[model samples]
Target: MDNIDRKMLEILQEDSRITIIDLAKKLNLSRPSVNERFRRLQEKGIIEGFTARISHEKIGKGTLVIIQIGNLKVVCHKFEEIVKEEKAILECHRVTGSDSYFMKAVVSSTKELEELVDRLVPYGQLNTSVVLSSPVSNRTLLPEDEFLHKN
Candidate 1:
């Protein structure tokens, strides 16, 4: 993608709520031009979708666990189906290396985490890590200024 596409992405990442007019003003471009760029970005699948990043802690999701799944070759198809039913499981991945799959789950308490563990046990040999704290988490890809300078 070019510099303008990168800049639009940067602005959206910071705040999805920013009005198209405001975005145009900030970028010093016409409203229609800004809208067109955004449209093209969406069409090219560069801009996937917008969503709010909610805090798990504020919503009573106090437990965070990273589960490593083994023996995925046996039940690859069923694994996706199983994880879909679970609300606590926020992220799932088919990873490389020793483990076949890695999943991040959030629960209300330790007991809930244990229950989540038990629920996953039947799938394969499970190794879980309870998260203590998150030092830095940058969900945003690139800032507008950074993207401009890089290009």
Candidate 2:
């Protein structure tokens, strides 16, 4: 993508609700041009679906936990079956390094967290950590992101 496309992505990542007119003004492009660019981005699969950031604590899911499941030969098809039924799990990824699977889950209380952990015991060696505070959580990516060059 070109600089203009990248800039539009950066803007959209910040606020997907921005009006076409406002976005055109920010990028110094015409409304029709900007709209076409956005349509192309979606058609090309460069832009995924937009989402709203929710406050988990306010919604009664106050506890956040990171779980690392190790000593697994594969992702284990049954793991997906079991995890899919759980709505508390926000994300689950098969990853490299010490952990075979990494998962993030949000729950209302410690009792709920324990129940979730118990159901996962048969999968692998599990290591779970409860998050107390987050200095940085979800930071949007841009063309000029420092993490992109750190490697």
Candidate 3:
């Protein structure tokens, strides 16, 4: 992808709901060209899909727990098959050291957390840490510091 494509991607990543006309204006390109580029990007699988970010607190799932999973081998192949049916697991990652995998789970109460841990035991050993509060969770993936970083 060229610089223009990357710029378009950056804009879209910030807010996917922006209109075609607005996007064209922002990128200083003709509407037809912008539309065509978007279509091509989609066709090439560069623009996979669009989705909304939902707040867990608003959805009545305020509790966040970081679960460290251990004693499991062959995670890449089997992990998906195992977790496909589970709904509470929001995110999972294979990690280094004593922890084989790190998982993010959303629960309503402490009892539910216990139950969730119980369910995960068959898959691997679980060490859960409840998030008391998050002062900041910077969800941005783009490099915002290149221009802003003073140092």
Candidate 3: stretches off by over 4 Å: 73-79, 134-138, 142-151
Backbone N/Cα/C clashes per model: 0, 0, 0
| Clashing residue pairs found in predicted model 1 | none
Give the higher-TM-score candidate: 2 or 3.
2
Superposed on all Cα atoms, the candidates' RMSDs to the truth, in angstroms, are 3.0, 3.5, 4.7
Query: All candidates' lDDT scores?
Result: 0.85, 0.87, 0.81
lDDT of 2: 0.87
1 or 3: which has the higher TM-score?
Answer: 1
- Ten-residue region with minimum lDDT total, candidate 2: 142-151
Q: Rank the candidates by TM-score, best first.
A: 1, 2, 3
**What is the C-alpha lDDT profile of model 2 across 1-151, one tens digit per residue?**
5778888998998898999999999999999999899999899788978899999999999999999898864467878778789899999998889888899999999999999988888778899999999999777665554533542
lDDT of 1 at 74: 59
